[model samples]
Target: MDKSFKIYVVVFLLLILGYLYLESTKKQPINWFPSYAENHKIPYGTYVLRNELKTFLPNVTIDEIKIPPYIYLEDSTRTGTYFFADEAINFGDAEFFRLMEFVKRGNDVFISTHGIQIDTLNFKTKRLVTGNLDEKVFFKFYNKAFKSKEFTFNRAFINQVFTKIDTLNTTVLGITGYVNANNERTNEGVNFVKFNYGKGNFYFHTFPEVFTNYNILNTEYEQHTANILSYVDSTKPFLWDSYYKTGKSGISSPMHYLLSSKYLKWAYYMALIGVLFFVIFEGKRKQRSIPIRTPLKNQTLAFTRTIANMYYEQQDHKNLAEFKISYLLEFIRTKLHIPTTTIDETFYKYVALRSGNTFEDVEKLFKFCDEIHLKNQISMDELIKLNKMIEKFKNTIQYGRK
Candidate 1:
């Protein structure tokens, strides 16, 4: 090989080697998005919680629920806990009502989200967004049994406390909030509560991140998560919700496989880069440039407008009306497919039927045109009237079919 070709090959090889080295050495960043998907292994996902739920309560039969509460509740009737843990579970009107009914029928519904408020049921939530960086949130159970150190989370966790509740039916289960900077024992409000409804109970918890993989896997924080779930009656069936998650369960698309892994994603990108490089370097095979040609413009509408304007400016309404009548006849022949040999009863009948206009309207329009055609000099009013009638008839036409 020549010296220049050898140099080109060497450069290409170096580029490929450099790309491989970069790809091998690159470190993927951590994803901190609060997806709350039971399948995701991200920091805020509940994958660890879902996998270890059986170990936590071996007696409880775990069933994965992929459909919405409304559809599932309507189709089947069962006694179990409908467990939901997500960053947000904003139920629709119908779904929420259906869920309430399900709970009323003596089935427990455990929902853990950022906030909880059912104004109709005399339950409300209060939020606190004070810029307190040092103060931490203290989460502890109100029950004296299983007494342990209060679990604390950093300032990243905000407050969504239960501010109001029905005293007769509601019971505070846990208190979690900044409460007080100097004294964590002070009550800001309760973040966890239990409501005694019809025949069942509603367990509401605001700290959804406790159910996430991060907290559940943390050695120091794992016990806290267990403490929260201690309230669940595990002897019954446990329906683990796969629905109402921010990061939906299974996302399948053409790019799903490649994008799911960094290596495959980068490999696909490298292939695209190679194609682009080939187009830039080797695609120019000494082909001659093809000249660009502009298409001809149709000036039919402009020409018609110019003629109409000239006729109006010269006050030749008689001839202009005649011209319009002639064009109208031609349009009817081509568009309506009726012969212009005579403007008789049969012609009017056919035109009316095809153009979707009443027979009387069609007959009246043709009579007016005929009257204008016979006049030597027509008024501007008569010309305008003729134009209006013609336009109205054309607008009502069902075109494209013969």
Candidate 2:
């Protein structure tokens, strides 16, 4: 590599580091997912709220419970405030009845969501849009503590408007609205409401995102949530729900424990990656290439040709004939599995039966073989005749077997 190129690479890496540092220092975007679980640290997660509650209410014990409201309160132990946060609360009739009965036992319930209805507390939500393309709005608490002071939020979202209120029992906690296209400041509707159920109170707030990390980090917005939480009974233990929004209260299994921890999880992943790379590189290095195999050269035809050439060059007709006769007898003994040491009528009959050849062919082939073996110097014509008879006998036996 060139010296200038190396310098360029170093400068590029430094720029990346600078950019990452700047980004980490900057505020993150608003996460709108409803995850009330304490493990999540995103903008919408209640992790900061849960921790802050611990500091603010040191005397009270905050428990994240996942069981149903009825089952959780069945022990009749100290009754405390139940806090439920989500996008919406669509409780079934049985659950709704159970929660109502639980609240009847002098236990308070605080629910924060976009909109919900419980018994007499009917909440009708609407969205208010103004001159701006993004529907951004401002809201203020209706209580006397804030003195009707308003604070503007940073992001644009659907401004939830509470249209109906059971005025006899419900009190408006906070109000929100947006300026219309006509440049008129319009109070769209209420955003927070509280109702008296039976012996206890039910606090329902529409703007759940106010308690999120993104808004709670802001001094102005943080005070709003603190003020809202002040309404809860701090004298009793707090039951922070981690079940409704997400169906999980704690770690699911051993896999979750392994992956949730920072160092242990990273170590596990690095070990797996190391094993994969080891298998790849070590397999490549240790594996030996297979040697190429050539077929065994058949020397049967070559040996036959050599023998035939030698016999013809020496003009040894009698020797060639005797060799052929011996080869035929050996072929019958080995291939047909018969005794061929004797040459007689009994031998012919046994060979005909075992070799699957006719008796006449067997007899003729044996006679020719015996005559050739007895000859001292056979003529070329007699050797040729014996060869033809041997070949004919082999063909007859092969045909019969087939």
Candidate 3:
């Protein structure tokens, strides 16, 4: 409607178009963070797996293990398989010992990750060397019961495989295959391994992404995850870990609920807007408006005119001439820096030199000055001529000296 508003709309539209162009041309962010938290719904998050575990095992109670294993050991009755899904399996010396003792007391612990901290357990990972540049990596269970033979992951990633295993107390479950530079397929890389502890077992799998929401949602991998979970002892209750992967253990936060709910978020924005409007309106009312200031009118010209008019009305030409002559003599003394006691040739020469005027002109002006003092009354013609000469002399002099 308005011209300024139309300009604003055009500028806003241009900005939007520019942003869209930049976004199209800009490189998308690489999602390298492995957020395996139960609450996160990202591609690599285990929210679906956590939920599926709850649904599939309804009879078994699944409690969150927030604190360290030592604290968890305080609960004497708490006995179940502690499930952990993360990018890495790092543990403190105390936590490691606690977990070992925990499993020794008939409790099991399942860890699915790409990395493990302890080196004592006999196992070495061998990364597949290949030049085929294949994005999909495949894995299949060693057990023959899985009707669907092998499952292939379409995403671009590397699969960790256990090349060495302690066959004395460990058993290999699944193996990952990789193509070498020679175009030969090798299945020596094992993805799953189970170690027997005191009275329980420690299950470790390299492919943790298979249990994530993105993979588990796929029908092909859903069965794959179920088959893996089959290894867990169903007789014992489940203990879902929500602390290590994420740093928190809870359903959700109060701030999260406030932000997620549309009404609450909108309410917060509206309250902020109301506060801004209040500050603006209140400031306008409280602060005083600056008054427009006009400079005082110059009355020098007006005063000169008024004095001239009064003198004309009174017919005081002689008095005016006398006053003009006196002022001219005083100006020559002060401004020209010359003695004015005698109005002779020497005075005329000094005045002419200081005022940058002709000697003749200075002499003529002083002649009028002498005549004005001698005569009792001055004629209008003479007064006018005297005024002209005085004004001419003033124009020649330096302003600063004046």
Candidate 4:
């Protein structure tokens, strides 16, 4: 109804609209990574390389191994002789020795592009060495577009070869085609190698991308993957270590993630409620008009007459003389429109000139009035002369005449 209330309503509507706009934008779900497996028609829940192993190691009767996050290596047993490392991390020295023992017992271990911490183990002493490779090499190999971008395969598979060659009783099998730093294809002498450890044979392929579905379909890597799988004996139980299947590592329970999301949602709702409460309670209230009360008009004159009659009835001479001087002073001020408090000589001069009276006469009249009030004494004739002077001063000021 009021102007201020209308402004508040308009502001409230704009705030609601703004909040809705923000919510609308926030409500839209964000898609982080595209569904590459679905789009490319790959089998769900299987890595590109592991999927290839199913066909490649058909003779070995491959058994897919699903390792849970933060697993105890000792608690788990392998039915087949092979272990796969996809992208799993936090595998300590004890686990490494257990794995090496498995290999020593005539088992095959296959590790992918990342999560291969083989350098941490000492083959001669059968102990952990606490060794770490350059992280830059791993990051580049995993993230770099192998098919779209040209990358040298020389350094790519060299680590795999070095791992096998450095180990006890391991031999060089063969190498894949090498490329120069400029991505130009070149023969770097060797691509892959083989190692003989007692009765067990260690085969290492440096180019893990060759086994991926993207590379398997390509003419260059398909033969390499097929050739590698051809070495497997199907009669022996096969273990597809899908432990390192996806690039994701350090996974938490689904319950923990969901609980955190719910807490954040509750905090957001509480903040919205607080803002709404402030707007409703602290906003201005409606204003009302205050009524006016007028005083009785003629009260001043009525009081003056009442006081005058009382003074006459009492007949108190000293008080009557003081009252008469006060009334005459007030009458002169009101009628002449001159301030009673003004003591300036120029004001008296102006009053004398306007009243056709001498300056000495006006001065004497004001002096006598003051003298009567202070002395509290006045003759009847002096009072009559004072009244006549007051009447004459009033008539001159009121009529605007000399």
Candidate 5:
């Protein structure tokens, strides 16, 4: 590599570092994730709601339940208003059964989420998009005493309301709606409902976004939040759930800061690209040429032909025939695993069966070889005939003829 090219490479790397540093220093935009976590101070987080609960209902003990209900509800003596607020609440079979038993013991459970699998209550919700670009939804209560003016939420990106509820058992608490494309104010769906399970009750609210810092901070919408909390018995203890949330209960990975920040994320991507470019360019620069060499030539067939020519020139038929017979018998013993100790009752049968040749052909070949073995001298044509018979017998084995 040239010194000038090295300087250029160094300058390029410095430029990348400068770009990453500037990006990392830039101001971050607002995060709109529905964390539903009490720790988060973001718009969709429940930090404000979590704090105000202590102030709204003064002197009441509101314990945060970070564990699942199945584990928490093990103590049958513990009874209170179990409050849960999130985008969606998912409960396992064990958790659901425990909650039912807990509620049956004359305790209340208040859940505010868009979706839930509560087959015991037989309820389902529908999420809707507004007709206008600037979205809107009005939260209204069914009770006349709680109803003042309709609480309007102009920043709703989506509205989730109960499309179907067990009407026979459930009593409506509130509703949410929007203006349609026809310029008409149409009721969307049920937002809240109260159902009596056993001695206690289960209050289900579809619009959980209301229980956030954004809604609670607004004077116009704060009343709506207050009215919703009023359903719970203030005198009893409140169990605030923190387990089932879109955001994690704790930061599990150390790479969260690097991955979550926009600038740092870009820097990480550039680092990978730099590594790839380095491999491609440096490999081309330092790569050595692989030399081509000739392979070893096989001399096995040449050596065998030279030996056969020597035997033919000297007219050594008797010695040649002895060598050929010894080699064939050794091959039959080692390769075919058949004995050549004696041409006995079982020799012909075994050879025919193992070599895939007919019994008659195997018997005639061996008998002819035996006669040749007794001869003192044989002619060239007799030697050629013996080689042809051996080849034909081997071909029967190769072709799998029985």
Candidate 6:
């Protein structure tokens, strides 16, 4: 019945539909470490070690330790040999002291490359053999290359010169030879020396590549390792330490470092603070609650008349026809509280009984209301008939309830 109200309904529906479409297209972010692990071939050994260390050595447990070749030797705890193919020649005073302490405790140590320099002058002293050398050459040494199958004087001289001065019982078990500079062939000494220390013994060999997994299968090295293992008490567990320095700095993956449990609580608190800041700074922006009024040239009735004029000006007969039918349906549903699913015959009978209207009158009103909606367009006369039917239907429901 009202042109202005019909326009309001169309605008409201458009706004709601637009809001829903925008919300559906919004994107959400996701964390993806589980997917990353599955794609890469990294072993889960670090996780396994962390769990086992916690279980066995509760007091001595380390939460996390970076495996090396990435830091300096002085900073590392070299409890065992650093088994790598490359040389670590930059042994500072601290590193040297640690290595000495490790060996003095009777623990065996292995070094693959031979050119480790402790001090510049001491290294030169070891390199050169000068005049005024003492008659008694006390260090034990064994160069197998120089010796014949039987015992020989040349091999014994070198062995005696290299042996530990404090431990007279120390001996060189085996050796291998190499070529010297100037195309001269000489016994460049390679030997295994064993020294007694406290309750245990220290075994040092110049050639260390023999113990690597790549060369350990060789019969000679296999026998060497087996012999060493035999001397070690099986009751004490052996440590397979592989820590070394690769001369680099900073973290590998900073995201992994940040996401670790060590920083998880701090990250959570930081996120909460960010959200709180957002709410205070952006969400609390001053909003206008008082409605602003613009001076209208026309009053409420005049504005309503203008909307009515537009409807008539457009000559939108189909829209007007549909509007009349929808308005009547909604009005009847609201006024009588009758569900849309109710049949017209049932509705007519109830209305006629309650309103004391003749059954024929109610039937005619229902018929005209249905005819206006089913037609594509309605004439001015037909519109008046539909309006009259809606008016009568509303009045009957109101009076009957009283």
Candidate with the larger TM-score of 1 and 6: 1
For model 4, residues 1-402, the per-residue Cα lDDT tens digits are 799998998897689668655764575354222122211223222346555665666556666555531232343454345644332334445455666566666655554342344554322111111122322121112112233222222122223324223546654444333333464443332334455554455444444554545545666545555655555556667665545455332335764454336455555655676787577656535434668988668788889899889876876556776666678667657755666677556666655644555568778777766666676565667666777766665666567445
Candidate 5 stretches with Cα past 4 Å from truth are 1-11, 128-135, 180-184, 257-402
- What clash count goes with each model? 0, 0, 0, 14, 0, 10
Q: Identify the runs in model 6 with alpha carbons over 4 angstroms from their true place.
A: 1-86, 102-112, 118-170, 178-188, 196-201, 217-221, 224-235, 245-402
Q: CA RMSD for every model?
A: 15.9, 31.9, 35.7, 40.2, 24.5, 36.9
lDDT of each: 0.81, 0.74, 0.76, 0.51, 0.81, 0.44
Judged by lDDT relative to the true structure, which candidate is superior, 5 or 6?
Answer: 5
lDDT for each residue of candidate 5 in 1-402, tens digit (9 for 90 to 100):
799999998898899879777877788877788889998888899999888887777767789998668668878998889999888788865578889888889898999887788875687767865656544577789888884567887564557777678878789998778765564676567878898878788999877878988889998889888888888887779999988888766666868877976767887888897888888898789989989999889998999999979997999887887787788788789878988999854687677656767668888888878888899998888788878778887887777653
Ranking of all candidate structures by their lDDT, best first: 5, 1, 3, 2, 4, 6
In model 4, where is the ten-residue run with the lowest total lDDT?
A: 122-131
Evaluate model 4: give its TM-score.
0.39
What lDDT, from 0 to 1, does candidate 1 have?
Answer: 0.81
In model 1, pairs of residues that clash are none
Tens digit of lDDT per residue, candidate 6, span 1-402? 289877886686577557545644555343211111111211211223223332333343132223322222334343332222222335534344555565455444433333454232122112212232222211123434433231111111112113222337455554444323343334434245555544344444443333333223344334443343343333333333334323222346766556543346355545775687577657768644778898767588988898789889987666776777677667657765656566576666555554545567778976776676577776777766667766766666667422
**If scored against the real structure, what TM-score would every candidate get?**
0.66, 0.53, 0.55, 0.39, 0.62, 0.28
- Candidate with top lDDT is 5
lDDT of 3 at 261: 52
Quote the RMSD, in angstroms, for model 5. 24.5
> Which residue pairs of candidate 3 clash?
none
Error of 3 at 102 (Å): 0.9
